[model samples]
Target: MTAGRKRDAVLRLLRAEPLEIVARELSVTAADLSAWREAFLEAGAASLKARERDDRDEKIDRLQSKLGEVLMDNELLQAKVDRLEAGGGGPFWVAEVEAMSPAVSISTRRPYGLARVCRVWGVARSGVYRRRRPADAPAMPRRRPGPQGPMPDAALVEAIRGVLLASPFHGEGYRKVWARLRHAGLRSSKERVRRLMRENGLSAPVRTGRPTGPRNHDGTIIPESIDTMWGTDMTAAFATEHGQVAVFVAVDHCSAECVGLHAALRGTRHEALEPVRQGVAERFGAVEKDAATGLSIRHDHGSQYMSHDFQKEIAWLGASSSPAFVRAPEGNGCAERFIRTLKENLLWVRTFRTVEELRLALLEFKRTYNEHWLIERHGHRSPAQFRRDQMDTMPLAA
Candidate 1:
């Protein structure tokens, strides 16, 4: 209800009308009418004391108005002081002064005087005049040339191109090409070769994407000497009638030589062991137990690798089973890298009619890879050549 109506009801209640009747007329409860009556009486009594409060409130309002005026004056004074500090006329701070000085001096009509600008900016007038001097007033002294390296000749460029074209591997990077040039009795720095290659539009394929994180395993798979460790992995290729055939391969870690390869219809635990058996028979010259002692076989956590039969077979052959880190392919990077190469050169590039045909093809690919595939880390020598070189360096057993 409005204040006037509420006050009228309270007055009715004070005039001795029945509280329920007045409350029913106003559509409010009797309790609400009683509370309003009490408040009205209190307000009537407070009004008698309101004269002094009114005077005090007027005084407080005057004081507040004065405070607002004083604050506004202070703000105006602060604005003037800020303008003075910022150097009133044109922009006169360091950056602003530098920007405006040139244009102000060069103005066609009523050009601003350098002396006036310098005084406003609180800088020496001579400095303003010196900066405003014409660019053609005196030419800047030419810079002296520094020592230069030997320039690459056209012969070097041709040699680099020849090396790239002659490379058996596709997408050879500049570093490998540089190494090849060095091997061919041509002397040039790697940076020079890289520049030449870039200028000539000779570049390795660009691999786009975020690179992987730090490798989980250090390059301990390829040891200093041969036969310390062997990495084994399996890859699959489609055969026309056989659907898919799994080809298992074993490689010497140090020499990168494919020791053995076998293709079969199934990738069972028994089939996974075939490459290891072949490697053992060839490397040790026998299939007896404990023949290939002190050798470590590295493989992933595939069911075939983890099976009891495969584990027992390797153990009986005197080789320890070394499982790679779970979900970390870098732990078996050597085997994985070899698999990629095998797929690129043989498996993905060729189709087989049957498992037997795939087997024969895998055997032929193994021989070709071992004899011809060049390992750059081994001075671009084939795996077979690297193995023979290492064997020659070893002292004959007594």
Candidate 2:
């Protein structure tokens, strides 16, 4: 029964029967039945008020959650718009927007996904899909009909674009851009500038140089300590009369120590791992009698590093592997520096006719790197010597 009906039944029984009999029949205590009767008479409105208060609290929490999500989405949208306004329309932004935008499925009503979105917004789907509006159309000056009507100057729009292109803020949005144009003797509003920029697709920044090296999404910051981390990267050289050759290089993070270098006509995971494995293993054996020191191995997020085979090999050596962020080479600064050094000292100095010739040159360089080359950061000692000295002084635990 409803609470109100049950309360009414209890009240009727309480008046018709003895207290003990009524309590037993109703499966409620005499005190509880009396409280229900008194509550029905005295505070029906108060109980309803309590229920409404709970509902309001629930609604407030949901709205707060929604507000937080909306704020986050707004921030992301603003970032995208800012990037577009700046003219940074490289693949990065496109890829980023594609990843962020919600995937829509429309196998039924709309001809295109974008069209469907426009329809939902109460805009004509066909018009949005066509997007025939010219970039400088909105910026064109309007003139009233008279004996002598004025015409919009096309040269002005071109001049505005030229100013924007020469500007460092070419890829930026309208407010700052308008101020820049005004300073350059061009009178234009921010909206007019934005319209001109959007029409020509001159608003996005182009990727000018080589792709920045691999990046890690998890924010794996590079270490500052010498020997705390090491990075390696591969660069391919043209094959001689035989085939294409690849060079594997590893360099120390803090000391600029050339840890290892190897060359092969074609480098597989095994080829890359062999030289590194040998160099590290020899170092371990050099300090064999002492406790092992931890080493961090950093590399690009290539399939070679991420592969199961590569991970297993590193695990066997008891060293941790860290990958650089996607398209971010600054994290692997040492490796990049080494690559430049190798190109200057070895590759640039002499051209190799074969893989064997390249291998021989790399071997000679590796020996000098480990035993002969003195780095100022290492107090004028070679990598091997510095490593030996550090190990000799390191305390051993009982």
Give the TM-score (vs. native) of candidate 1. Answer: 0.58
Model 2 residue 45 lDDT? Answer: 69
RMSD of each: 25.3, 22.6
For model 2 the local lDDT of residue 361 reads 85
Candidate 1, residues 85-110: lDDT per residue as tens digits? 87785434454445544442221223
Models 1 onward score TM values of: 0.58, 0.40
Superposed Cα deviation of residue 72, candidate 2 (Å): 62
lDDT of 2 by residue, 221-322 (tens): 445445667787888765467667888887777556677778876667877775566557555563232222477788888766777887777666666788
Q: How much is the lDDT of residue 314 in candidate 1? A: 91
Q: Model 2: what TM-score?
A: 0.40
